[model samples]
Target: MNSNQQNSDHWLVRPSTIRGLWIGGSILLALTVFLQFFIKIKGYFVVDGWLGFGAVFGFLCCVAMVLVAKGLGRFIKRDDNFYQGGNSDD
Candidate 1:
């Protein structure tokens, strides 16, 4: 490695690549939702029949999981030095 030369960055970490990925993912998500208009969806529940319900429900579920995990973390977390010393008694 040359001291004066810059290190090569990964393609996935590049800002342009990240923006392109976001654009592609958004297009795919929109296409799936738009296709629902042409197809007959046999939803098990009434709420599932609403347009964009899947996307909304999925997003809400993810948020709920994050909240639950954060709450649980409070109860389970240990101090930074919890394991620093072999014995609890100094």
Candidate 2:
């Protein structure tokens, strides 16, 4: 198929739309963090007062996961046709 046909028709496909969405979402998240101080989080652990802690934690966790996956891939990756032609007797 042609490039145009292969592309999706999603609303945020355009750069301007995606930029606007990112700006809007950042504003909304900032507002949420600003409003969080007045409220108390009944968590078993402290650091609840830290604004955007959850977002930071989740982002860091995902980055660490990707790094770990890449490190593991070095050990776990196999050559091409490893399963197709090799080890057929086993």
Instruction: Note the residue pairs that clash in candidate 1.
Output: none
Candidate 1 lDDT tens digits, 1-90: 453332376778767889999999999889989998998777899889888888889889999999999999999999998878766665
- Candidate models: Cα lDDT each: 0.86, 0.78
Q: TM-scores, in order shown?
A: 0.76, 0.59
Cα lDDT for residue 24, candidate 1: 100
> Which tens-of-lDDT digit does each residue in 1-90 have in candidate 2?
566854665767766788999999999878877777887656556774476777678779999999999999998999987868855666
Least well predicted 10-residue stretch by lDDT in candidate 1: 1-10
- Specify the highest-TM-score model's number: 1
Model 1 lDDT vs. the true structure?
Answer: 0.86
